[model samples]
Target: MSKIRVAVFGCGAIAQRRHIPEYASNPNVELVAFADPNKQRAEEVAAEYGGKAYENYEDILKNEKLDAVSVCTPNYLHAPMTIAAANAGLHVLVEKPMAVTAEEGEQMIEAAAKNNVYLMVGHNQRLMPPHVKAKEILESGRLGRVLTFRTSFGHPGPEGWSLDGRDSWFFRKDEALMGAMGDLGVHKSDFIRYLLNDEVVEVAGFIGTIHKEDTDVDDNATCIVRMKSGAIGTLMASWTHYKGGDNGTVLWCENGVVKIGTGQGDEVIVELTNGTVETYKVGAMATNEKQVPSGVIDDFVQSIITKTPPTISGEEGLRSLKVILGAFESQDTGSIVKL
Candidate 1:
């Protein structure tokens, strides 16, 4: 089998940390091209990873013969890049918060379907080891039904992580669309939905730029969500956790509770009504401070090889994105918005 030729559309923090490295590590993939507005960044990535660097992504799409492309650009560019890639007959693996709006997400999906190519979204939280184990436990019916839960993803902003530091496009509303919610909240929303095997039906939340200075986008967001299965929970995202980061989730179930990404040593801790306690050292989660193999790149490659839809397909991405959009609408109207 020929190696899947791949291009990365952004050479920023995410591309350098996750997409580029993962794609390079995949034996079945070839790093063929890189595109970024920063010519130096793109050239550096290309020099290190073996690819042609392009100042414009359109050049790569029009000129490169590639099997797939990773759309690791800003939130605003996800839709356009994916659409163009799909139209070019290349499979797309797009980063999270799939697009700025539901309509854009739908268009991306349509383009992929029309072109008969895979469209995968980078909702990698579901693939986290602890979260995977938690889902297994929930599916085993050991925790009965999840009644309510709380999940959060927070850190001391993206300044330290982004390549551009504090001035990164993440802080700009025009580029990021929604700040903390788009960056972190969407991950939690998709995660909870995946864990419960349910969909968010309604959402109400408070989102604002609480601490970050001179940023129009929200630095923090807290939402109450009602799932279609009648499960209710709070979803929180913040870029103002000065001390450290939190990617913890606690589920209150009918029979007991499942705690994930909380314990110091154990990645998952379960306490049952029958007094049975189980602790799992599944693995460490990928954080802004620590980089881990997300399993997303491998999955994307395998899906193309096997000619199957990605686990996190475009439709699934759209579903998860709608939850974030609903929260934003909720914030705007000060009322519960239905998904």
Candidate 2:
């Protein structure tokens, strides 16, 4: 394919902020179509990006001659849309929390494999500059094995970012599945796994809707995760951080402590046990106020063009989702859930 013809399945906040713009900017991608339930939103995106507007996503899958699609729809729609696109012989780059249930994630993966297409999940935390640097440091064996860690991703809420404002589907249980945990927790879970190169084997947490009104889903969650290597850490997600956002991770290792995304300008800070301090000035983390290229779109497009599996594959997404699900089970049962 000369230029991978791409269509966006949702014209909402994530599509506008990340997917469409990145695809348009990518020299290897030709963004060809946009689909959304809201016709006007789709039309506006198409007008800006030079594509056809589609009100129904099925129409795009049926009519468009596309090589790939970014499934940027709500959480509930991710599995079905990706399965459909894969069945149509198109590669899929789906948003985080790949599906509502593990079964759905498995089905999406099966569809992609059966159709012989790439299925990438948008777990963009691993693409952040600070996170990339931190991973490198850990791999060097300088940190000597992480003992304990804490990673958090929080903001005021999706209301400030979602196109639907306070009434966004992010707060709906049916559409979003889980609120703060699904939106923010999964990112941290995936990040922790990437940083440690280990799976989260056990999860115990307290997840609830503490502050948000008129929402059945949780507004805050605090999970204690134990990795396969016996490293324990805390993973927190909050939509009620009214003051400001915190996307920071701190890993206390045998040799030193590595801090990521905690500094104002410096993105990574390392404090050694032998009284040495090192800092890195990687770029800022993407936030609602300031959007940056997440690198997910480029990775997905390149994987399709090169006929290779994406960095964040469907199985990786499913693993991250399983962590969040285990946390939910722990919350419900008041006992540690084993993954």
Model 2 lDDT tens row, 1-339: 489999999999999999999998999989899999999999999888898999998999888899999999899999999999999999999999999899999999999999999999999999988889999999999889999999999999998999999999998889998999999999999999988999999999899999899989999999999999999999999999988689999999999999998877337999999999999988877888888889999888888777889979999999999999999999999999999
Q: Runs in model 2 with CA error above 4 Å?
A: none
| Cα lDDT for residue 5, candidate 1 | 98
How many steric clashes between backbone atoms does each model show? Answer: 0, 0
Best by lDDT: 1
lDDT string for model 1 (1-339, tens) is: 899999999899999999999999999999999999999999999999898999999999888999999999899999999999999999999999999999999999999999999999999998988999999999999789899999999999899999999999999889998999999999999999899999999999899998889989999999999999999999999999988579999999999988998877238999999999999998888888788899999999999999989989999989988999999898899899988
- Candidate 2, residue 175: the lDDT equals 96
TM-score of each: 0.99, 0.99
Task: List candidate 1 stretches off by more than 4 Å.
Answer: none
